[model samples]
Target chain A: MRIFTAVVAIAAGILILGGYFFPAFEGMQALLLNWAVILAGAAALVGIFNLVSVHTDKIRRQEKGSVYSALLLISLVATFLFAMILRPNHATMKIVLSGIIIPVEASLMGLLTISLLYAAVRLLRRRADLTSIIFLVTAALLILGSATLPFGNMPVLGTFVGPWITQVLALGGARGILIGVALGTLTTGLRVLFGADRPYGGN
Target chain B: MIELTIILVSAALLFGITLWKRKSPANLREIPALTRLHRTLGLSIEDGTRLHISLGTGSLLDARGGSALAGLAMLRHIAERTSVSDKPSVASAGDPTLGLLTQDTLQAGYQAAGVEELYVPTSGRVTGLSPFGYAAGAMNISQNENVSANIIIGHFGPEAALLTEASDRDNVTMIGASDELSGQSVLFASTQDSLIGEELFATGAYLGAGASHVASLTVQDILRWLVILALLGGAAVKLVGMI
Candidate 1:
């Protein structure tokens, strides 16, 4: 089964990738991608069902915070029903998104700042390596210089050092990292294409 | 055309390297993050505590899927190593497609370890749909599941801070890797150990997933140098033309 799956996966990958360089294979590629999209949508449904079952089990088991699980299930059912019946473009559905979902994610985003600060402090306390120290110092300088100071602006740190570090140093490092990431992604994709890595086949 | 040529070249190099190094173990540079992860995996098995792997919200339908694949590679190794433990490893993924694959990967790992009976499908979960929601869900698992270590590897954003913070509060050893630059920055500050940029893809190689992985690393190095040379050569050519 694994070998069968591997052969199918490799052929699909090759055809899809091949379409990019040769237009002759595009029809096959499009067909494969369409199948992928349908499969992905079904996979998402299965994932949601898995989520529902997990919470349901938690409630049945009377585990800790089962009340939360119950609440989640209720919300999930309500949203799913509303989105399905109302076609998702209805104002009621939008409110559920804007009123409930957006605000909740917004609150978490607001909380993220504090979380980042706490983590940074923890990082310094835990590691205290040269790289950590440099990272901390650079961040401190960038944050301090990022905003308009009460004095309108800092003379040195804000204007020169901050801009230099971010634009020159950080950008260069980021580009290097991006190039490395691209290389890695390429190899990984190639491996899958050549059937050397059978992540899908579980070999 | 160029992209195709590069891919073909890389494939050739990988096969060549694999055959050349088939008789001997390839020597690899030490990455402290992976070294620490190796130790943590061992400790979790010995201590009978589970390791939690967060595959993040990387959809397999897009470019972001690369990181999720890396996460799966790491999960495969962790699950196999911890398969015999009283508390087997749990994997949480944010995407449905990824969640399904993760379950299969977990099962395969258990099968490899000769303990497929102990594999639980729920152990590979789709925590949430949205980013923050996923982070919160994953955070809860590490906090409440007696997890000895947290492996956060995939595409992530600032929401990763929440997971790292939760791990920190619980004193669980956490190592993070992300394909996103923002995610990398967040991980650098938040986690004790992080695999920056392409280092995320090297997890499988470090974990001994297969010889192909090691061969791919060598290919990566060779290709990296070629890219550098091309860039420099292009600039030099342009400079001469300008003069």
Candidate 2:
């Protein structure tokens, strides 16, 4: 069964990749991609069911935070029913997305910024290497340079150092990381294609 | 056409080297995060606390799939090691498809270790579909489940900081990695020992997935040098043109 699954996966991958290189198989590629998306959707439905079942079981067992589990189930069921009845694009959906989801996510982003700042301060405490010192100094400079002054913006510091730090140093580091990620992605894909690594649960 | 050729040639080189070097030992550089993973797992088992592995919000069909798959490979290794313990390592993913894959990896690991009865469906779960939702769910688990160690490697955004913070609050040993650059920055600040850039992909190799994974890492190193050389060559050409 694992071999069969691997074979199917390889065929699908090849077909999709071939379609990109060969125009003749474009339709077939689209069909296969659609099939994959559908399969994913089905898997997501199963996941939803599993989530509900797990929470239900937790509540049944009277586990810690069972009230939270009950609340989660109720919220999920309510949202599902609303979506089914009122349609997803209704005003209620917009309100939920804009008012509830956006605010919650925004608050989380704020928390992340604070967490990052706190971590920056503790970086030296954790590992006081030269690299850590450099990281801390760079972070401090960027923060100080970017901060608003009482009189006016510190153009020399903010305009110069901020852009240099963010545009040059940060961008360079990010690009290097991105290049590494791309190389890793290619190797991983090739590994799967050549049957070197089977992530689909095969031996 | 050039891109395709380069990919094909690189893959061929990788396969060739893998076959040729299969029997030879791989002398890989020391990765502290990976090295500490074994000890962390042992501590988790000894402490009778769960080891949490989070494969972040990455889908199987998207670009993030590679990282998700890599995380699954790591999951297999951790699961096998923890299969004998009363509480095996638990896995969570933001994507349901990846979640299912995580479960399969767990089951496969247990089966391979001849401890099929230790496999539990609830051990691998899809925490949430959205990034923040997933982070929240995973954070709750890390805090409440008495997690001794939290290994997070996959695609994540800034929301990952929340999980890191939660784990930190609980005094859990956190090792993190992410394919996204922004996520990497967050992880760098937050994790105790974080895998940077392509290091996440090396987890399988470092964890003894197989010789193929080791060979793949070697191939990556070779390709990286090639890229560096190409960049230098391009810069030199521009310089010559200016002269």
User: Pairs clashing in candidate 1?
Assistant: none
lDDT of 1 at B87: 94
Give the poorly placed runs of model 2, Cα more than 4 Å off.
none
The alpha-carbon lDDT assigned to residue A157 of candidate 2 equals 77
TM-scores of the models, in the order given: 0.96, 0.96
Model 2 pairs whose backbones collide:
none
Per-residue lDDT over B1-243 for candidate 1, one digit per residue giving the tens place of the 0 to 100 score: 788888888888988987776777979999989999999988888899999999999998899887887788778888888899989988999999999999998988998999889988889899998899999888878877799999999989999999988888888999999999999999999887799899999999999888888888899999999989998999999989963
Error of 2 at B62 (Å): 1.9
Give lDDT tens digits, candidate 2, residues B122-174: 88888889999899888877876767889999999888889988888888899
Interface CA RMSD of each prediction in angstroms: 1.2, 1.4
**C-alpha RMSD values across all candidates:** 1.6, 1.7
lDDT (10s digit) by residue, model 1, range A45-130:
99999998888988999977788889999999989988999989999998998998899999999989999888887887878899
